[model samples]
Target: MQSLFERIDRLNGKYNALVSLDRPRALQRAREADLAQARGQSWGPLHGVPITVKDSFRTAGLRTTAGYAPLRDSVPDRDADAVARLKNAGAIVIGKSNCAPLCSDLQTRNDIFGTTGNPWEAGRTAGGSSGGEAAAVALGLSPLGLGSDSGGSIRVPASYCGVYGFKPSIGKIARDGLIPPLGDPAREDSLTVVGAIARSVRDLALSYSILSGEPYGIDAAPQHAPRIAWTGEFPRQLMDDEVSSALEAAYRTLSDSGASVEKVEPPLDLHFLNFKYFMLNMYEFSPRESSPGLHKLFWLFESARSVFSGGIEANYKKLKADQREQVDLFDRFAQQFDCWALPATPTAAFHHQKSGRPIPIRHRGKSKRYSYWHATGGFAFLANFLGCPSVAIPIGRDRNGLPIGIQVVGRREQDTALLRTAAHIAERIGSTMPLAT
Candidate 1:
């Protein structure tokens, strides 16, 4: 506990990864934990282990702003359900990590804590709104962090920082006290999920169990080769050479390890699915109310597309059927394949840029201008749209030495099995944890 505090004191200023810390309170709890241990008392698996949470999660007595100004001094008297579960499992929160203001943006920056720099490159972006959580985990400031993902928040940041992140099936982790809540909590089902970002898959598994009430099957190795399904490339998505090559190399490793890897296209149209995502997000999230320019324009474009395709009512029925098809098709997919493999994002971490601007994507003399969405799209939303489980595993790095990663997805409610498959692959391909140096 002292070591973690010392490291944060020494390095957090440089990274701005941690926004609010409860050092005094945390240290007291740590000492109490030590005394309990001395008396042979065990809190749980994570007893006395220090960890950090995304600032968006309300931690009892700890200030949580979600990077919004009005809530700067806000302190909740109760923990978010997921946060309480972590605390119940003996995970001590040393601090709260930074996030995008009100958890609205894709990059981590706000008036409260400035911006979170990528652990690999200071000038590049740390993906958000879970950016600070990933940066902290990667830089050894924290071993594990809780992140919320309605979009690509968890996986994108983990890929950017060369760490592991997991998003379990919808409602796998309770979501009562999250700031800028995405889905309607009154309902039992969810489109958003609370998940874990960690330096290793084992930590993610433990955290998942604590959060979801699942088994803590640590070091779960698949007994046989996994039947893997992957798109050689997603249709119409432009990717950097480095990112593409790294993924292809990972496929080679999985194949060499005896996995039956097959190239296949996504079962549904991606553009259509993305439109479904935007349509549903309109009601579930409120980011667009604050977002200007492109945010509004994207909504307008999708709305127009809906009208162009007959009408919203017509598409609503189509989408409802599509949702059912998503369930049925994926059930059969789960029977045939252990997991689906794909890149977490289209490119490796790029230099920090504004959200509405065009990004220059270049590789081996090929250069093109891409919108922010095109550049950041890593096929991540597929899992979110389908309510599937997804895990981002760092496989290699780009020429600029930034990390590259791929997400393996599993059927809804099969998070533990997917994680085990990921662990099996990690064991075969070797540990990809970034040196916190």
Candidate 2:
């Protein structure tokens, strides 16, 4: 544990993966754990294992800013429910990792903690808002990291950093005390979930079991071989050739392993679904009313107008209706297949850019640029919308040696089954790769 802290201290400056550390406390806990073991006291499964929690999770006495400058000094009186559960399992929280401001962006950068770089390439982004966690795990700074995913936060970073990330179905784990809080309408809707990022599928499974308070059960592989569905293309989205090829290779591996693989049309309109998702989040994040006085008066007027015109509420209802339709469609599709596979991202890690510009990709012999959100969230948002479990596992590398990942999605509330399936696929395809230096 001490050596891990020393390595973090040495490499943290270059990767900016961890923004804050509770080294003394973590070391003290480690010593106590050692002594307890020596005394024949049984410890938890994660006893003495060092881990980093995403800054968005509130940790008692540990500053959790969520990369927001105004909250730089904000320290919670209690750990987030998930964090507390992990602690109870004897994991020592070494530090808080960087995140997007308010956990809103796809890249880890904010006024409080500049930006986290990809462990494989310093000039590229690590992916966010769990980018820091992924980078830290990929660089061997931590064995496991706790992260949150509303859209693609956990999966994107895992894909970019060549690690394993598992987002369980919403409501599987308690959500109290996360930044943005339970009172926030966005969280009230349960779009975000506490998840884990790690170097192996087994770590994800263990962490999920500990954090969710559910025993990790094995899903017996089908005697007749499981059926897998996949889609390589998305509407109005451009996928890099390498990413597409890697996904295809993964499908071929499953097919070769006796799993029936078939190409299928996407069950929903991704563009419309993503658009509604963005608008819904925007409304949820927006202030309910302005400060008192003239601003408050104007806010009242706007609220009244919206109420009379059936504005925000109407839009929200329509979004929910559409979401239900898509979820229903997905459920029907899942009934016919054991898992759905898709590209984790349109491309591998791209160069870090502050402007939040559209990312360019060549498709069908033409060059096109997609907004960063759409590029990364295209395949990932569906999981959140449907409240389903998904796992991202590194498959292979691109020409530039950047890691490529494929996502395996399962039915809602079937997190353990999804993890088991992911582990099986990982073994079949040899998905485990050495971490980047």
Candidate 3:
């Protein structure tokens, strides 16, 4: 049988999922893993696996781009803290996958890297900002890959591409080297997180535990069936009929499996949600510490608007105002539920060229323009805004036969519990995709 790295290379042209390939290094690690096994020394859980990473991750000596030109040539001397942990657990980094510009957009295409196409439909988008990583795993380009989710970057792509992606409870996985590195004493804090995208929930959990370096402890043992909250109608609007039906079916599957499942409509503040999202995200380009390129971008915004109009000041005010609401939302959700479940994206993968643009997702014959075509990530942003964890599981296919996914989010630091629940749900729903023939 061909080694995993070889298999990925063989499929590269067809999928166009990977932006770079480190064949020699991956083969070197494979040989080392085989030798260690022969010596009766178990390398680690992911030993010998050829894993890919979103270019946003800082892999020592590898081209790390959050899919931007300015940072393309900027190689880090150290592996991202998460990357370091994965390596310690014996997973070899085979290559850096593509991502959005500055990891900013929802689609993976950017001026730096062309685009990442879907495995299921080559002409459709693979999903973004972690689209490339999801595409790789979905196409079996790699057994697993690591990605970051700021606003559904991980889950959206996985949902569209029919793969597994998890945004572990905030701070569960060390975020020292994730792109747009935040929390630098000299820098402002933004709400971005590093997570994993894989073909199976087991792979997602395994990668998280490896990165966390936490003793399995209480979570090592199998978990009992969970009480799940499945929301069919989105907090903002009713979802597409086909998409909503898939989610409802998934809930029924869990119920039949003996897990208690409820359909609840939680109140949400859409404006506050969007405000906080834009604020925290845009805060990354803070004038005090941003690079010249970012500064120039901000300058254009300032110049475009009238000085008397409170141009940049309005943006700051909205951000600060939303921060308060952001805190309230987090506190309220912690009290009411163990986790919230909903569609990860409204629809499946669309045509490849249409990846990044916002499209009208029709629900009950009423069309509404969402944030992005995959904007059903309204469920995902809740987890991110609150610094919570969420896992996306493939539910079934949409009308087009592309994958449909649902996300289950949990309280902060409940990473393992959420993973366990998703695993149980996937088992009940029979959602795992068959290997591509």
Candidate of highest lDDT:
2
The ten-residue window of minimal lDDT in model 3 covers 283-292
RMSD of 2: 3.5
Deviation (Å) of 409 in candidate 1: 0.4
Candidate 2 residue-wise lDDT, 132-218, digit = tens:
999999988999999999889999999999999999998898878887642546425647888999988889999999988888665
Q: Residue by residue across 1-437, what tens digits does model 3's lDDT show?
A: 14665667677677667887777777777888989999998868877777898998888888787777767677789999988888888888989898877666667787677887788877777878898999888877788899988888898899988888988766677777877653463334456778899888887887887888765433455544576776777454446667877877877878877877878766466445755665465554322333457556755765566376567767556565666576577667645655677778777676755543565667777776655633545556666766778888888897778888888887677777778777777778847887552
Question: Which residues of candidate 2, in runs, are more than 4 Å off?
Answer: 182-187, 219-224, 285-309
lDDT of 1 by residue, 271-383 (tens): 76776676555535645434657467865776787877877556656666776776787777667888888888888887888775766777545998777766774377778
The better candidate by lDDT, 2 or 3, is 2
Q: After superposition, how far is residue 416 of candidate 1 from its true place, in Å?
A: 0.8
lDDT of 2 at 187: 26
Ranking by lDDT: 2, 1, 3
- Give Cα distance to truth, residue 83, candidate 3, Å: 1.1
Q: How good is model 3 by TM-score? A: 0.87
